[model samples]
Target: MAQVVTCRVKFIPLQLEFIATFVYVYNMKEDRKELWDHLSQLSGNHKEPWIVLGDFNVVLHREDRLGGNPVTLVEVTDFQNCIDNCGLEEIANSGSQYTWNDKQDARIFSKIDKVLVNGEWVDQMPDITAHILPEGISDHCPLVVQMLQSFSRKENQDREAMRRIQMQLQLTPLNATIQKEEKELSDKFRRSIYLAESILLRKQSNLD
Candidate 1:
């Protein structure tokens, strides 16, 4: 009953657009072909920015597994070939490196879960971070992806200073001042985003 969920997202105020496809692949090896085919078809013709994430139930290399039977190249190649066919690149994640663990008598751990994106998505969010959270109620860990923040060395220092200030102010009424300042900073960021979006729309309308 598990299928893929595909949706388009548009940040109307920012006029930014991207598509996301979430897949819960078949667990059996033979059924993987069907999963690969479904993804390949979606990624085939268009270059729209896309991010696909889920339990793929397949791995691409030896290091992706620990203990149990070693996966043959023949087994891994199908998933690799499918990624190649779709021009999808896997997003590297930290935290729980491996996603699934068969903790029975045999005991096996595998990195069969993933988040992948196309080159266009890479161009859009070059420093995107895909992080893995704890596997709470399932065998597979949850993956979270977000755009990376860019900052100058001075800016980083400034943020660290602000963090220290916030920590210190936590015991004082100045904490209210810090909170107000944080709200103002957030509003400024939103305003900048709106300005950028207006400029993008204006330029696009001019071209039209």
Candidate 2:
């Protein structure tokens, strides 16, 4: 079955974080553009830095191939177009370059696995990089993706706004039962109330 895997890296340089999604297609020949379009839609909706990686089955160039019927010229062009359209760049591949192989031929290898990142996310990863690792039990090799930390102002503001909204929602009972003493106490205990409100908000949001 085809599968999508994701991992998140947070706070390396200053306060930047990234969510990386890897798509591993088993035997499907889905268009590369379709996959990139899907990723683009997701990023537009979330408005967060994203890294997309995995074995796309299609190679972007002849340099990426090892042996045996290489990916067609048309396919390579399509793959390149997909990467360009998605606004993602391929990260460096390391170690034994080839990522996939056929059991029958030891020399049959191909660099199908790849690591891609959104251009906006480049600043967050200062020193870290992505590379291809060795294959163990499977035909495909594992990849190592190193990430750095850098915080964006947008994420911080979003969090703060969310906190304020949560605080307002938690003050519901206070509006209904505005006892003189209760209101006075609530005003005085603003810090404590905010903390309590935030905790509950996180919990409720998680449930939803």
Candidate 3:
């Protein structure tokens, strides 16, 4: 079987770390743990914010699985411990009843996919939501998460306040000079009109 693929995306403005992984079916236990451990070590060491998401085949609890048999007790406990020990939080798992279905058997269904994140990343990020999208050709339902990346309200308002202060401070002598020049031009136009009228009056006096 082919190995799972992992990728990272760094958004500079938001100072975010987005780590993505896709795990294949065979040897899910060791492969998922190895992939997760790599991301988890990075999360622990780095001070900057980060989020991790992928197809984790093992379910953490009975609630995580929709209709599967509750027979794998030890595996479920180990998986839940892995998530907790890595300090990742699962977000919005109620959208789909199952992520994978038994092709031969219609009644058996299970959810083994999820989106997980750390605490620091969730604080600044908003409208972080996920839904199970339709996948006609594949066995796995597509996990879709809408990431709204922008400055928060407090940060934006703080920037506007600083801009107002800077503008007020810079509006000192140059603006005053321009206003004075405008008034002087008006006075010069009035004086020219008066002089023209006086010249016309003198010519009329001479004619009389």
Candidate 4:
């Protein structure tokens, strides 16, 4: 019920090793129960930062269905139970209440697409939000994630690295040795700044 693609994202020179999983899930409840089982087993496999985004082919609540036959409690429970079991938190979206639409009728609207993240991802990106885009060629509206990572990361990393330097300096007693370490730490700090700036420039360039 899921076709998964994995990729390693790299920023040149920094050599950060980050892996991203792109999962496209088609959970047609009538088609199979395998998907429900898969969702139940997913959260146990990941204990670190992660995100899941795509058309889920399911809606969590009655509000997710705008003009369809009144959503059944069974339907809502089926969709939300998977989310709850997997420990995935849906990121609140702005701009649109629903994503999927029946091509024939504007009245038939449903929010089946979403962006879900785990506890670690939430801890790292508390300010992230999902941006629901206008419907395109497909019956589904596109979605974009507005992330605070690029803006907040450099500041937080710099602060933590400097804190480490400060702690090391405090713990080392001898004045001459302290100055020596301070100079070394200052050099390392400058390199960190340069790397962070390079990454910032790349992000700005991409945005432009």
Pick the lDDT winner: 1
Q: What is the number of backbone collisions in each predicted candidate, taken in the order shown? A: 0, 6, 0, 0
Model 1 off-target regions past 4 Å? 151-208
Question: For model 1, where is the 10-residue window of minimal lDDT?
Answer: 149-158
Inter-residue clash pairs, candidate 4: none
Decreasing TM-score order of the candidates: 1, 4, 2, 3
RMSD (Å) per prediction: 15.1, 13.2, 21.8, 7.2
Give the range of the ten consecutive residues with the poorest summed lDDT in model 3: 148-157
Encode model 3's per-residue lDDT on 1-208: one tens digit a residue: 2435656777553344555545553345665566555555666675443556656667766765545576378767656665676677877744676776655464556677777777655543443667877546777788888753332443444445445544654665367654565454444344334434444555568699
**Model 4, backbone clash pairs (residues 3+ apart or across chains), number:** 0
Q: Estimated TM-score per prediction?
A: 0.68, 0.59, 0.58, 0.64
The lDDT of each candidate is 0.73, 0.63, 0.58, 0.68
User: What is the C-alpha lDDT profile of model 1 across 14-125, one tens digit per residue?
Assistant: 4668888888877788887877888899898578788888878888788999998888998888899889998999876788878888757876889988888998775443
Residues 24-108, model 4: lDDT tens digits: 6556665435565665676676565567777778787778888868888876676677678877788778988899888884478
TM-score of 2: 0.59
lDDT for position 129 in model 2: 68
Ranking by lDDT: 1, 4, 2, 3
TM-score of 1: 0.68
Candidate 2 has an lDDT of 0.63
